[model samples]
Target chain A: MDEARSAVRAARRSDLHALTDLRLHFLGEAAHADARLRLMPDARDRTEHALPVWMGQADRVLLVGLDPAHDPQGPGADNAAPVAYAMGLLGAVPPVLAAQHVGEILEVHVDPAHRGKGLGDALVAILGEALIGRGAQVLRAAVPSTHEFARARLERAGFAPLQLELERSLDAG
Target chain B: MAATFASWLQDPARLVVVAEEGGRMVVGFAAGVVLQGNGWQIPARLGRITDAYVARPRRRLGIARRLAGRLLDLLYEKGVGTVRLAAAVQNEGALAFWQSMGWSDLETVLERAVPVEGRDPEA
Candidate 1:
Protein backbone atom coordinates (compact mmCIF):
# COMPACT_ATOMS: atom_id res chain seq x y z
CA MET A 1 0.00 0.00 0.00
CA ASP A 2 1.32 3.43 -0.93
CA GLU A 3 1.63 6.24 1.59
CA ALA A 4 -1.17 8.81 1.40
CA ARG A 5 0.32 12.32 1.52
CA SER A 6 -1.84 14.82 -0.40
CA ALA A 7 -1.36 18.52 -1.09
CA VAL A 8 -4.10 21.05 -1.47
CA ARG A 9 -3.35 24.07 -3.65
CA ALA A 10 -4.98 26.99 -5.46
CA ALA A 11 -6.21 26.23 -8.96
CA ARG A 12 -3.65 27.07 -11.60
CA ARG A 13 -4.03 27.38 -15.37
CA SER A 14 -2.28 24.04 -15.63
CA ASP A 15 -5.05 22.57 -13.46
CA LEU A 16 -7.75 23.41 -16.04
CA HIS A 17 -7.84 19.94 -17.46
CA ALA A 18 -7.78 18.39 -14.03
CA LEU A 19 -10.49 20.72 -12.73
CA THR A 20 -12.67 20.16 -15.78
CA ASP A 21 -12.21 16.48 -15.34
CA LEU A 22 -13.27 16.76 -11.72
CA ARG A 23 -16.32 18.86 -12.69
CA LEU A 24 -17.35 16.40 -15.36
CA HIS A 25 -16.81 13.52 -12.99
CA PHE A 26 -19.21 15.02 -10.48
CA LEU A 27 -21.44 17.04 -12.80
CA GLY A 28 -21.21 15.71 -16.36
CA GLU A 29 -23.94 13.13 -16.08
CA ALA A 30 -26.39 15.66 -14.68
CA ALA A 31 -26.80 17.45 -18.04
CA HIS A 32 -30.60 17.15 -18.17
CA ALA A 33 -30.91 18.42 -14.58
CA ASP A 34 -29.80 21.87 -15.77
CA ALA A 35 -32.77 22.27 -18.10
CA ARG A 36 -35.18 21.48 -15.31
CA LEU A 37 -33.60 24.12 -13.10
CA ARG A 38 -33.55 26.72 -15.93
CA LEU A 39 -29.76 26.69 -15.46
CA MET A 40 -29.40 25.28 -18.97
CA PRO A 41 -28.30 28.62 -20.37
CA ASP A 42 -25.69 29.00 -17.67
CA ALA A 43 -24.59 25.41 -18.05
CA ARG A 44 -24.47 25.48 -21.83
CA ASP A 45 -22.93 28.90 -22.22
CA ARG A 46 -21.93 30.90 -19.17
CA THR A 47 -19.83 28.17 -17.53
CA GLU A 48 -17.30 28.32 -20.34
CA HIS A 49 -17.59 32.09 -20.45
CA ALA A 50 -17.24 32.55 -16.70
CA LEU A 51 -14.65 29.99 -15.59
CA PRO A 52 -11.50 32.00 -16.30
CA VAL A 53 -13.08 35.33 -15.40
CA TRP A 54 -14.45 33.74 -12.28
CA MET A 55 -11.01 32.35 -11.54
CA GLY A 56 -9.67 35.87 -11.82
CA GLN A 57 -12.34 37.33 -9.54
CA ALA A 58 -10.80 38.35 -6.21
CA ASP A 59 -13.42 36.70 -4.02
CA ARG A 60 -13.37 33.35 -5.85
CA VAL A 61 -11.24 30.39 -4.85
CA LEU A 62 -11.00 26.98 -6.53
CA LEU A 63 -8.92 24.39 -4.72
CA VAL A 64 -8.09 20.72 -5.15
CA GLY A 65 -6.48 18.17 -2.90
CA LEU A 66 -3.99 15.95 -4.69
CA ASP A 67 -2.47 12.73 -3.45
CA PRO A 68 0.61 12.19 -5.57
CA ALA A 69 1.57 8.88 -4.04
CA HIS A 70 -1.65 7.08 -4.89
CA ASP A 71 -2.71 9.32 -7.78
CA PRO A 72 -1.51 9.40 -11.35
CA GLN A 73 -0.30 12.80 -12.62
CA GLY A 74 -2.28 13.37 -15.84
CA PRO A 75 -5.86 13.20 -17.14
CA GLY A 76 -6.28 9.94 -15.29
CA ALA A 77 -6.10 11.73 -11.96
CA ASP A 78 -8.91 14.20 -12.59
CA ASN A 79 -11.63 13.59 -10.05
CA ALA A 80 -10.52 10.22 -8.87
CA ALA A 81 -7.08 11.51 -8.02
CA PRO A 82 -8.52 14.25 -5.86
CA VAL A 83 -9.72 12.67 -2.64
CA ALA A 84 -11.51 15.94 -1.80
CA TYR A 85 -11.92 19.54 -2.90
CA ALA A 86 -13.47 22.87 -1.92
CA MET A 87 -14.45 25.35 -4.62
CA GLY A 88 -16.41 28.59 -4.36
CA LEU A 89 -16.27 32.39 -4.38
CA LEU A 90 -15.24 34.76 -1.60
CA GLY A 91 -18.10 37.00 -0.60
CA ALA A 92 -17.98 40.58 -1.84
CA VAL A 93 -18.27 43.27 0.82
CA PRO A 94 -21.63 44.33 -0.49
CA PRO A 95 -22.91 47.44 1.23
CA VAL A 96 -26.15 45.60 1.92
CA LEU A 97 -24.40 42.79 3.76
CA ALA A 98 -22.56 43.89 6.89
CA ALA A 99 -19.99 41.14 6.80
CA GLN A 100 -16.68 42.19 5.35
CA HIS A 101 -15.61 39.02 3.56
CA VAL A 102 -17.59 35.83 4.03
CA GLY A 103 -16.22 32.54 2.76
CA GLU A 104 -18.79 31.13 0.36
CA ILE A 105 -18.13 27.44 -0.20
CA LEU A 106 -19.99 26.61 -3.37
CA GLU A 107 -18.88 23.02 -3.72
CA VAL A 108 -16.95 20.74 -1.43
CA HIS A 109 -16.98 17.08 -2.26
CA VAL A 110 -14.88 14.06 -1.42
CA ASP A 111 -14.82 10.68 -3.04
CA PRO A 112 -17.24 8.45 -1.13
CA ALA A 113 -14.52 5.87 -0.76
CA HIS A 114 -12.21 8.45 0.76
CA ARG A 115 -14.69 9.85 3.25
CA GLY A 116 -13.65 9.88 6.96
CA LYS A 117 -10.01 9.74 5.93
CA GLY A 118 -9.40 13.44 6.75
CA LEU A 119 -9.35 14.42 3.08
CA GLY A 120 -12.46 16.51 3.47
CA ASP A 121 -11.07 18.06 6.61
CA ALA A 122 -7.76 18.76 4.87
CA LEU A 123 -9.51 20.37 1.93
CA VAL A 124 -11.45 22.59 4.33
CA ALA A 125 -8.28 23.55 6.15
CA ILE A 126 -6.63 24.49 2.85
CA LEU A 127 -9.69 26.49 1.74
CA GLY A 128 -9.85 28.20 5.11
CA GLU A 129 -6.19 29.13 4.93
CA ALA A 130 -6.63 30.48 1.43
CA LEU A 131 -9.65 32.51 2.52
CA ILE A 132 -7.89 33.90 5.58
CA GLY A 133 -4.92 34.84 3.43
CA ARG A 134 -7.30 36.83 1.25
CA GLY A 135 -8.63 38.78 4.30
CA ALA A 136 -11.73 36.79 5.13
CA GLN A 137 -12.46 36.67 8.87
CA VAL A 138 -15.91 35.11 8.72
CA LEU A 139 -16.48 32.02 6.62
CA ARG A 140 -19.91 30.87 5.47
CA ALA A 141 -20.19 27.50 3.82
CA ALA A 142 -23.43 27.31 1.82
CA VAL A 143 -24.36 23.69 2.09
CA PRO A 144 -27.74 22.82 0.66
CA SER A 145 -30.61 22.73 3.14
CA THR A 146 -30.59 18.96 2.85
CA HIS A 147 -26.88 18.16 3.02
CA GLU A 148 -26.32 16.42 6.34
CA PHE A 149 -22.74 15.49 5.55
CA ALA A 150 -21.85 19.08 4.71
CA ARG A 151 -23.51 20.46 7.83
CA ALA A 152 -21.59 18.01 9.94
CA ARG A 153 -18.35 18.97 8.22
CA LEU A 154 -18.87 22.68 8.75
CA GLU A 155 -19.93 22.28 12.35
CA ARG A 156 -16.86 20.19 13.02
CA ALA A 157 -14.81 22.95 11.38
CA GLY A 158 -16.19 25.54 13.86
CA PHE A 159 -18.72 27.22 11.56
CA ALA A 160 -22.22 28.10 12.66
CA PRO A 161 -24.93 28.71 10.10
CA LEU A 162 -25.89 32.40 9.88
CA GLN A 163 -27.97 33.97 7.13
CA LEU A 164 -30.79 32.46 5.11
CA GLU A 165 -31.94 33.39 1.65
CA LEU A 166 -35.67 32.84 1.14
CA GLU A 167 -37.05 33.20 -2.35
CA ARG A 168 -40.47 32.77 -3.96
CA SER A 169 -41.77 33.29 -7.46
CA LEU A 170 -44.46 35.87 -7.94
CA ASP A 171 -45.48 34.34 -11.26
CA ALA A 172 -46.68 31.29 -9.35
CA GLY A 173 -49.46 33.39 -7.90
CA MET B 1 -41.45 39.89 -8.07
CA ALA B 2 -40.87 42.67 -5.58
CA ALA B 3 -37.20 41.78 -5.36
CA THR B 4 -36.91 41.71 -9.14
CA PHE B 5 -38.75 45.01 -9.34
CA ALA B 6 -36.58 46.40 -6.54
CA SER B 7 -33.44 45.39 -8.41
CA TRP B 8 -34.82 46.94 -11.53
CA LEU B 9 -35.51 50.13 -9.65
CA GLN B 10 -31.85 50.21 -8.66
CA ASP B 11 -30.71 49.89 -12.28
CA PRO B 12 -28.06 52.54 -12.85
CA ALA B 13 -29.68 53.67 -16.08
CA ARG B 14 -32.83 54.64 -14.20
CA LEU B 15 -31.24 56.15 -11.07
CA VAL B 16 -29.54 59.50 -10.86
CA VAL B 17 -28.47 62.03 -8.26
CA VAL B 18 -28.70 65.75 -8.70
CA ALA B 19 -26.37 67.70 -6.44
CA GLU B 20 -27.70 71.09 -5.47
CA GLU B 21 -25.88 74.30 -4.42
CA GLY B 22 -22.70 73.96 -6.48
CA GLY B 23 -22.45 70.18 -5.78
CA ARG B 24 -21.96 70.61 -2.05
CA MET B 25 -24.90 68.37 -1.14
CA VAL B 26 -27.23 65.96 -2.88
CA VAL B 27 -30.54 67.77 -3.42
CA GLY B 28 -32.35 64.80 -4.94
CA PHE B 29 -31.82 61.10 -5.66
CA ALA B 30 -34.16 58.98 -7.78
CA ALA B 31 -34.24 55.20 -8.24
CA GLY B 32 -36.35 53.21 -10.71
CA VAL B 33 -36.24 50.35 -13.26
CA VAL B 34 -37.05 49.69 -16.91
CA LEU B 35 -39.81 47.17 -17.63
CA GLN B 36 -39.83 47.17 -21.44
CA GLY B 37 -38.01 44.66 -23.62
CA ASN B 38 -37.71 43.76 -27.32
CA GLY B 39 -40.79 43.81 -29.59
CA TRP B 40 -44.47 44.02 -28.55
CA GLN B 41 -44.28 40.68 -26.77
CA ILE B 42 -43.61 42.48 -23.50
CA PRO B 43 -46.03 44.97 -21.98
CA ALA B 44 -45.47 48.73 -22.09
CA ARG B 45 -42.18 49.95 -20.67
CA LEU B 46 -42.29 50.25 -16.89
CA GLY B 47 -40.32 52.70 -14.73
CA ARG B 48 -40.82 51.47 -11.18
CA ILE B 49 -39.60 53.48 -8.22
CA THR B 50 -38.12 52.01 -5.03
CA ASP B 51 -37.19 55.23 -3.33
CA ALA B 52 -36.58 58.90 -3.99
CA TYR B 53 -34.66 60.00 -0.92
CA VAL B 54 -34.37 63.76 -0.77
CA ALA B 55 -32.90 65.47 2.27
CA ARG B 56 -35.58 65.43 4.94
CA PRO B 57 -35.02 69.10 5.74
CA ARG B 58 -35.48 69.84 2.03
CA ARG B 59 -39.01 68.41 1.78
CA ARG B 60 -41.92 70.34 0.17
CA LEU B 61 -39.35 72.62 -1.42
CA GLY B 62 -40.05 70.73 -4.67
CA ILE B 63 -36.71 68.91 -4.43
CA ALA B 64 -38.34 65.53 -3.68
CA ARG B 65 -41.18 66.10 -6.17
CA ARG B 66 -38.82 67.41 -8.80
CA LEU B 67 -36.59 64.38 -8.32
CA ALA B 68 -39.58 62.07 -8.80
CA GLY B 69 -40.63 64.01 -11.90
CA ARG B 70 -37.15 63.73 -13.37
CA LEU B 71 -37.11 59.98 -12.61
CA LEU B 72 -40.38 59.64 -14.54
CA ASP B 73 -38.90 61.63 -17.39
CA LEU B 74 -35.98 59.19 -17.53
CA LEU B 75 -38.40 56.25 -17.67
CA TYR B 76 -40.37 57.91 -20.45
CA GLU B 77 -37.16 58.58 -22.32
CA LYS B 78 -36.33 54.87 -22.06
CA GLY B 79 -39.81 53.87 -23.42
CA VAL B 80 -40.90 52.08 -20.21
CA GLY B 81 -44.49 50.75 -19.87
CA THR B 82 -45.52 50.08 -16.24
CA VAL B 83 -43.77 51.02 -12.98
CA ARG B 84 -44.15 49.46 -9.50
CA LEU B 85 -42.51 49.18 -6.03
CA ALA B 86 -43.23 47.81 -2.52
CA ALA B 87 -43.00 48.74 1.14
CA ALA B 88 -41.96 46.22 3.75
CA VAL B 89 -44.66 44.14 5.52
CA GLN B 90 -43.67 45.53 8.95
CA ASN B 91 -42.17 48.81 7.89
CA GLU B 92 -45.23 50.99 8.36
CA GLY B 93 -43.14 54.15 8.37
CA ALA B 94 -41.54 53.17 5.10
CA LEU B 95 -44.95 52.07 3.80
CA ALA B 96 -46.40 55.42 4.72
CA PHE B 97 -43.43 57.11 3.11
CA TRP B 98 -43.98 55.22 -0.14
CA GLN B 99 -47.75 55.55 0.02
CA SER B 100 -47.44 59.26 0.53
CA MET B 101 -45.34 59.24 -2.62
CA GLY B 102 -47.98 57.10 -4.44
CA TRP B 103 -46.38 53.62 -4.12
CA SER B 104 -48.22 50.42 -3.15
CA ASP B 105 -47.42 46.83 -2.19
CA LEU B 106 -47.69 44.54 -5.18
CA GLU B 107 -46.36 41.33 -3.58
CA THR B 108 -45.25 39.65 -0.38
CA VAL B 109 -42.56 37.11 0.42
CA LEU B 110 -43.39 34.35 2.93
CA GLU B 111 -40.68 32.37 4.68
CA ARG B 112 -40.71 29.10 6.63
CA ALA B 113 -37.79 27.43 8.39
CA VAL B 114 -37.14 23.73 8.79
CA PRO B 115 -34.38 22.18 10.90
CA VAL B 116 -32.20 19.28 9.85
CA GLU B 117 -29.14 17.77 11.54
CA GLY B 118 -29.03 20.65 14.02
CA ARG B 119 -28.65 23.07 11.10
CA ASP B 120 -31.08 25.77 10.06
CA PRO B 121 -32.77 24.40 6.95
CA GLU B 122 -33.10 27.92 5.55
CA ALA B 123 -29.44 28.75 5.88
Candidate 2:
Protein backbone atom coordinates (compact mmCIF):
# COMPACT_ATOMS: atom_id res chain seq x y z
CA MET A 1 0.00 0.00 0.00
CA ASP A 2 1.45 3.40 -1.07
CA GLU A 3 -0.87 5.57 1.04
CA ALA A 4 -3.71 5.09 3.52
CA ARG A 5 -7.02 4.95 1.59
CA SER A 6 -9.98 5.68 3.85
CA ALA A 7 -9.74 2.24 5.46
CA VAL A 8 -10.22 3.21 9.08
CA ARG A 9 -12.72 1.28 11.21
CA ALA A 10 -13.30 0.03 14.75
CA ALA A 11 -10.75 -2.56 15.75
CA ARG A 12 -11.65 -6.23 15.72
CA ARG A 13 -10.20 -9.18 17.58
CA SER A 14 -8.02 -10.03 14.62
CA ASP A 15 -6.53 -6.54 14.80
CA LEU A 16 -5.09 -7.00 18.29
CA HIS A 17 -1.44 -7.13 17.27
CA ALA A 18 -1.85 -4.22 14.90
CA LEU A 19 -3.54 -2.17 17.58
CA THR A 20 -0.78 -2.88 20.07
CA ASP A 21 1.92 -2.02 17.57
CA LEU A 22 0.67 1.47 16.71
CA ARG A 23 -0.29 2.27 20.28
CA LEU A 24 3.15 1.29 21.53
CA HIS A 25 4.72 3.53 18.93
CA PHE A 26 2.80 6.48 20.34
CA LEU A 27 3.84 5.62 23.88
CA GLY A 28 7.45 5.16 22.83
CA GLU A 29 7.46 8.50 21.09
CA ALA A 30 5.95 10.12 24.13
CA ALA A 31 8.55 8.64 26.45
CA HIS A 32 11.31 9.70 24.13
CA ALA A 33 10.16 13.32 24.23
CA ASP A 34 9.31 13.47 27.95
CA ALA A 35 11.43 12.10 30.76
CA ARG A 36 8.52 11.92 33.16
CA LEU A 37 7.03 9.05 31.16
CA ARG A 38 9.98 6.67 31.53
CA LEU A 39 9.11 3.09 30.82
CA MET A 40 9.88 0.28 33.20
CA PRO A 41 11.89 -2.84 32.29
CA ASP A 42 8.67 -4.81 32.03
CA ALA A 43 6.66 -2.15 30.22
CA ARG A 44 6.23 -4.10 27.00
CA ASP A 45 5.19 -7.26 28.80
CA ARG A 46 2.63 -5.47 30.94
CA THR A 47 1.12 -3.48 28.08
CA GLU A 48 0.94 -6.50 25.83
CA HIS A 49 -0.91 -8.47 28.46
CA ALA A 50 -3.36 -5.68 29.24
CA LEU A 51 -4.19 -4.85 25.61
CA PRO A 52 -6.15 -8.00 24.83
CA VAL A 53 -8.31 -7.53 27.91
CA TRP A 54 -8.78 -3.90 26.95
CA MET A 55 -9.84 -4.94 23.48
CA GLY A 56 -12.69 -6.95 24.99
CA GLN A 57 -14.02 -4.04 27.02
CA ALA A 58 -17.43 -2.60 26.23
CA ASP A 59 -16.68 0.91 27.54
CA ARG A 60 -13.70 1.48 25.26
CA VAL A 61 -13.43 2.10 21.54
CA LEU A 62 -10.27 1.17 19.62
CA LEU A 63 -9.98 2.13 15.95
CA VAL A 64 -7.58 0.87 13.35
CA GLY A 65 -6.48 2.45 10.05
CA LEU A 66 -5.70 -0.06 7.36
CA ASP A 67 -3.85 0.44 4.05
CA PRO A 68 -6.66 -0.44 1.68
CA ALA A 69 -4.67 -1.96 -1.16
CA HIS A 70 -6.07 -5.47 -1.17
CA ASP A 71 -9.01 -6.53 -3.31
CA PRO A 72 -12.04 -4.33 -2.48
CA GLN A 73 -14.76 -6.71 -3.73
CA GLY A 74 -13.69 -9.90 -1.99
CA PRO A 75 -13.07 -11.06 1.62
CA GLY A 76 -9.63 -9.48 1.20
CA ALA A 77 -10.99 -5.91 1.21
CA ASP A 78 -9.89 -5.47 4.84
CA ASN A 79 -7.00 -7.94 4.63
CA ALA A 80 -4.36 -5.19 4.60
CA ALA A 81 -2.58 -4.63 7.91
CA PRO A 82 -3.41 -1.65 10.08
CA VAL A 83 -1.07 1.34 9.80
CA ALA A 84 -2.67 3.52 12.50
CA TYR A 85 -4.82 3.30 15.61
CA ALA A 86 -6.81 5.47 18.03
CA MET A 87 -8.69 4.71 21.22
CA GLY A 88 -11.27 6.34 23.50
CA LEU A 89 -12.90 5.49 26.78
CA LEU A 90 -16.43 6.21 27.94
CA GLY A 91 -16.37 8.27 31.12
CA ALA A 92 -18.17 11.01 33.02
CA VAL A 93 -17.28 13.89 35.29
CA PRO A 94 -18.56 14.29 38.86
CA PRO A 95 -22.32 14.38 38.94
CA VAL A 96 -22.32 17.63 40.91
CA LEU A 97 -21.62 19.45 37.68
CA ALA A 98 -23.92 19.36 34.67
CA ALA A 99 -22.86 15.75 34.32
CA GLN A 100 -22.93 14.23 30.87
CA HIS A 101 -21.45 11.08 29.43
CA VAL A 102 -17.97 11.71 27.97
CA GLY A 103 -15.61 10.00 25.61
CA GLU A 104 -11.93 10.57 26.26
CA ILE A 105 -9.41 10.09 23.46
CA LEU A 106 -6.45 8.54 25.22
CA GLU A 107 -4.18 7.88 22.24
CA VAL A 108 -3.92 8.25 18.47
CA HIS A 109 -0.98 7.09 16.41
CA VAL A 110 -0.12 6.39 12.80
CA ASP A 111 3.01 4.57 11.71
CA PRO A 112 5.98 6.77 10.81
CA ALA A 113 5.70 5.86 7.15
CA HIS A 114 2.03 6.76 7.22
CA ARG A 115 2.65 10.16 8.76
CA GLY A 116 1.58 13.29 6.76
CA LYS A 117 -0.97 11.25 4.88
CA GLY A 118 -3.80 12.67 6.96
CA LEU A 119 -4.28 9.28 8.56
CA GLY A 120 -3.98 10.76 12.03
CA ASP A 121 -6.73 13.27 11.34
CA ALA A 122 -8.93 10.61 9.85
CA LEU A 123 -8.50 8.38 12.88
CA VAL A 124 -9.40 11.17 15.31
CA ALA A 125 -12.44 12.34 13.37
CA ILE A 126 -13.79 8.80 13.05
CA LEU A 127 -12.92 7.98 16.65
CA GLY A 128 -14.73 11.05 17.91
CA GLU A 129 -17.75 10.27 15.79
CA ALA A 130 -17.77 6.66 17.03
CA LEU A 131 -17.71 7.78 20.64
CA ILE A 132 -20.62 10.13 20.04
CA GLY A 133 -22.59 7.31 18.51
CA ARG A 134 -22.07 5.38 21.74
CA GLY A 135 -23.76 8.16 23.78
CA ALA A 136 -20.96 10.58 24.56
CA GLN A 137 -22.12 14.17 24.86
CA VAL A 138 -18.61 15.61 25.19
CA LEU A 139 -15.11 14.51 24.25
CA ARG A 140 -11.78 15.23 25.90
CA ALA A 141 -8.10 14.57 25.30
CA ALA A 142 -5.12 15.36 27.52
CA VAL A 143 -1.87 16.22 25.76
CA PRO A 144 1.45 16.96 27.32
CA SER A 145 2.54 20.58 27.11
CA THR A 146 5.78 19.79 25.30
CA HIS A 147 4.16 17.85 22.48
CA GLU A 148 3.34 20.58 19.98
CA PHE A 149 2.54 18.12 17.24
CA ALA A 150 0.02 16.18 19.30
CA ARG A 151 -1.70 19.34 20.50
CA ALA A 152 -1.81 20.70 16.97
CA ARG A 153 -3.31 17.43 15.78
CA LEU A 154 -6.13 17.69 18.31
CA GLU A 155 -6.74 21.32 17.39
CA ARG A 156 -7.01 20.35 13.77
CA ALA A 157 -9.57 17.74 14.80
CA GLY A 158 -11.73 20.45 16.44
CA PHE A 159 -10.66 20.07 20.09
CA ALA A 160 -10.27 23.30 22.02
CA PRO A 161 -8.31 23.96 25.19
CA LEU A 162 -10.68 23.54 28.08
CA GLN A 163 -8.92 22.89 31.38
CA LEU A 164 -5.55 22.45 33.04
CA GLU A 165 -5.06 19.43 35.25
CA LEU A 166 -2.80 20.12 38.20
CA GLU A 167 -1.31 17.13 39.98
CA ARG A 168 0.45 16.39 43.30
CA SER A 169 1.82 13.09 44.50
CA LEU A 170 0.75 12.31 48.03
CA ASP A 171 2.82 10.37 50.57
CA ALA A 172 1.23 7.05 51.42
CA GLY A 173 -0.75 7.31 54.70
CA MET B 1 -26.37 18.28 43.38
CA ALA B 2 -28.44 16.70 46.12
CA ALA B 3 -28.59 13.39 44.31
CA THR B 4 -24.85 13.45 43.68
CA PHE B 5 -24.13 14.20 47.31
CA ALA B 6 -26.37 11.40 48.45
CA SER B 7 -24.72 8.95 46.12
CA TRP B 8 -21.22 9.98 47.21
CA LEU B 9 -22.22 9.67 50.85
CA GLN B 10 -23.23 6.06 50.20
CA ASP B 11 -20.07 5.06 48.34
CA PRO B 12 -17.05 3.74 50.21
CA ALA B 13 -14.44 4.70 47.65
CA ARG B 14 -15.57 8.33 47.55
CA LEU B 15 -14.71 10.98 50.12
CA VAL B 16 -17.08 13.87 50.82
CA VAL B 17 -16.15 16.44 53.46
CA VAL B 18 -17.47 19.82 54.42
CA ALA B 19 -16.46 22.51 56.87
CA GLU B 20 -19.08 23.85 59.17
CA GLU B 21 -19.23 27.03 61.25
CA GLY B 22 -21.53 28.89 63.64
CA GLY B 23 -22.88 25.55 64.89
CA ARG B 24 -24.91 24.76 61.72
CA MET B 25 -23.88 26.78 58.70
CA VAL B 26 -21.95 24.93 55.97
CA VAL B 27 -19.07 27.10 54.82
CA GLY B 28 -17.17 24.82 52.44
CA PHE B 29 -17.00 21.35 50.95
CA ALA B 30 -14.50 19.04 49.21
CA ALA B 31 -14.80 15.80 47.28
CA GLY B 32 -12.26 13.11 46.33
CA VAL B 33 -12.49 9.76 44.61
CA VAL B 34 -10.22 6.73 44.28
CA LEU B 35 -9.73 4.81 41.02
CA GLN B 36 -8.40 1.33 40.27
CA GLY B 37 -5.47 1.63 37.90
CA ASN B 38 -4.34 -0.82 35.24
CA GLY B 39 -0.95 -1.20 36.99
CA TRP B 40 1.00 -0.70 33.77
CA GLN B 41 0.05 2.81 32.80
CA ILE B 42 -1.03 4.19 36.17
CA PRO B 43 -0.63 3.19 39.78
CA ALA B 44 -2.81 0.53 41.33
CA ARG B 45 -4.82 3.09 43.29
CA LEU B 46 -5.18 6.74 42.27
CA GLY B 47 -7.00 9.64 43.84
CA ARG B 48 -8.63 12.68 42.29
CA ILE B 49 -9.87 15.89 43.89
CA THR B 50 -13.08 16.15 41.97
CA ASP B 51 -14.55 19.21 43.58
CA ALA B 52 -13.65 21.85 46.16
CA TYR B 53 -15.69 24.88 46.95
CA VAL B 54 -15.92 27.51 49.71
CA ALA B 55 -18.60 30.11 50.30
CA ARG B 56 -17.81 33.54 48.86
CA PRO B 57 -17.98 35.18 52.29
CA ARG B 58 -15.43 32.67 53.58
CA ARG B 59 -12.74 33.53 51.02
CA ARG B 60 -9.12 33.27 52.22
CA LEU B 61 -10.39 32.24 55.65
CA GLY B 62 -8.46 28.91 55.52
CA ILE B 63 -11.77 27.06 55.27
CA ALA B 64 -10.97 25.69 51.80
CA ARG B 65 -7.41 24.84 52.86
CA ARG B 66 -8.58 22.94 55.91
CA LEU B 67 -11.18 21.13 53.81
CA ALA B 68 -8.58 20.25 51.17
CA GLY B 69 -6.13 19.00 53.78
CA ARG B 70 -8.73 16.79 55.40
CA LEU B 71 -9.90 15.43 52.06
CA LEU B 72 -6.33 14.65 50.91
CA ASP B 73 -5.59 12.96 54.24
CA LEU B 74 -8.61 10.74 53.72
CA LEU B 75 -7.39 9.84 50.24
CA TYR B 76 -3.94 8.95 51.61
CA GLU B 77 -5.62 6.81 54.22
CA LYS B 78 -7.15 4.88 51.36
CA GLY B 79 -3.61 4.12 50.02
CA VAL B 80 -3.58 6.36 46.96
CA GLY B 81 -0.13 7.20 45.57
CA THR B 82 -1.03 10.45 43.82
CA VAL B 83 -3.87 12.93 43.58
CA ARG B 84 -4.94 15.23 40.74
CA LEU B 85 -7.50 17.92 40.01
CA ALA B 86 -8.48 20.16 37.10
CA ALA B 87 -9.31 23.85 37.13
CA ALA B 88 -10.35 25.90 34.15
CA VAL B 89 -7.58 28.12 32.79
CA GLN B 90 -9.65 31.25 33.41
CA ASN B 91 -10.16 30.41 37.07
CA GLU B 92 -7.08 32.21 38.29
CA GLY B 93 -8.18 32.31 41.89
CA ALA B 94 -8.97 28.63 42.01
CA LEU B 95 -5.70 27.75 40.26
CA ALA B 96 -3.66 29.90 42.62
CA PHE B 97 -5.53 28.49 45.57
CA TRP B 98 -4.71 24.96 44.50
CA GLN B 99 -1.08 25.91 43.93
CA SER B 100 -0.88 27.31 47.46
CA MET B 101 -2.27 24.02 48.70
CA GLY B 102 0.61 22.20 46.86
CA TRP B 103 -0.84 21.19 43.47
CA SER B 104 0.99 22.24 40.30
CA ASP B 105 0.15 22.29 36.62
CA LEU B 106 0.60 18.87 35.03
CA GLU B 107 -1.52 18.43 31.92
CA THR B 108 -3.69 20.39 29.55
CA VAL B 109 -7.14 18.93 28.97
CA LEU B 110 -8.84 19.78 25.66
CA GLU B 111 -12.50 19.29 24.88
CA ARG B 112 -14.67 18.97 21.78
CA ALA B 113 -18.41 19.25 21.49
CA VAL B 114 -20.24 16.38 19.87
CA PRO B 115 -23.41 17.38 18.07
CA VAL B 116 -26.58 15.43 18.78
CA GLU B 117 -27.13 14.74 15.13
CA GLY B 118 -24.99 14.45 11.98
CA ARG B 119 -21.87 13.27 13.79
CA ASP B 120 -20.85 10.84 11.12
CA PRO B 121 -17.50 12.04 9.88
CA GLU B 122 -17.12 12.03 6.14
CA ALA B 123 -13.37 11.73 6.34
Question: Evaluated with DockQ, which candidate comes out highest?
Answer: 2
TM-score of chain A of each: 0.70, 0.84
Instruction: Please give, for residues A122-152, the per-residue lDDT of candidate 2 as tens digits.
Output: 8788888778877888899998766788889
List clashing residue pairs in candidate 2. none
RMSD of each: 11.7, 4.0
lDDT score at residue A147, model 1, on the 0-100 scale: 48
lDDT of 2 by residue, B1-123 (tens): 688789999999999999999879998899999998654455578799988999899988898889999998899989987898889988899889988877876678899988767443431
If you assessed candidate 2 against the hidden native complex, which CAPRI class would it receive?
A: acceptable
Cα displacement (angstroms), candidate 2, residue B85, comes to: 0.9
Instruction: Show how many residue pairs clash in every candidate, following the order shown.
Output: 9, 0
Clashes of 1: 9
Q: Is the docking of candidate 1 incorrect, acceptable, medium or high quality?
A: incorrect
